[model samples]
Target: MQTHYEQEERFRLAKKRVDELKGFYGNLVSYIVVNLGLMILNLMTSPEHLWFFWPMFGWGVGVLFHAMKVYGFTPFFGKDWEERKIRQFMEEEKKRNESFKGE
Candidate 1:
């Protein structure tokens, strides 16, 4: 059986993992967004008949990533993986601290 200490430790670890993942992918997402808009503009102006395919394919991939991040309930990973875990950690910590102070 798990104890409170164990649960707290697990929560802390989960938050750390999410923070690390966010650090790694956060910038990548931004880069992809900026480059993607430019790519789309190019596709629109390009003379090649199929230049649009590249941005369309890239956009579909981006949306799929967003979907997995928001609704995914996986622990310590996936799209909303980090934010959700950190929010839970903060809420638990806040509650624990509040109870300690009789707040």
Candidate 2:
């Protein structure tokens, strides 16, 4: 269990992380949507256009990568990922408790 101070600090960090994640998500949306619209525009205009296909392919790749990061197997969970700090604290707490109990 975290002390009050530790909890407060964690909350602060979490809020900051949430803000960062929101910004990241927004940027991802803009990139994917804009590029996709461009791809569609190019397609609708001229299917035989070579350049359109390449930019579309590039944008598709970027969208796929972003989608994977946002929804696929990511350790961060797309949020405030303080796993290392929390794990370290838990270990220390366990050790402290064991010492107290003379384990």
Candidate 3:
């Protein structure tokens, strides 16, 4: 029952979401591959000092946040909340405009 414009909008949003997923996955793969290399290098070069975990943990946190955002698991201001706020503001603006037009 949706119009063409609505359908196109949906498709656009879906495509954007897919792109986000792709980016997040690429980041994740890079994190793993690079971290593995760093870990091996650290172990070989300075097993006693053990410094690989620092970057690993920091990058892991970043990856976790990226995953959370891409997957819409954000605890605050998630996608649904954002959409609702957008609609709410649009409706309010429409009402205000209509009221002014009546005057």
Q: Pick the candidate with the highest TM-score.
A: 3
For model 2, residues 29-91, the per-residue Cα lDDT tens digits are 887687778778877887687465576577667766665664534555533456777888999
Over 3-57, each residue of candidate 3 has an lDDT whose tens digit, in order, gives 9999999999999999999999999999999999999999999999999999999
Compare candidates 1 and 2 on TM-score and give the better one.
Answer: 2
lDDT of each: 0.71, 0.73, 0.97
User: Which pairs of residues collide in model 1?
Assistant: 69-79, 69-80
Question: Model 3: what TM-score?
Answer: 0.77
Q: Which residue pairs collide in model 2, if any?
A: none
Off by over 4 Å in 1: 1-4, 13-17, 20-28, 31-52, 55-59, 62-66, 73-103
Better of 1 and 3 by lDDT: 3
Off by over 4 Å in 3: 80-103
Model 2 regions lying over 4 Å from their true place = 1-4, 56-103
Q: Name the candidate that leads on lDDT.
A: 3
Mark the 10 consecutive residues where model 3 has the least summed lDDT. 71-80
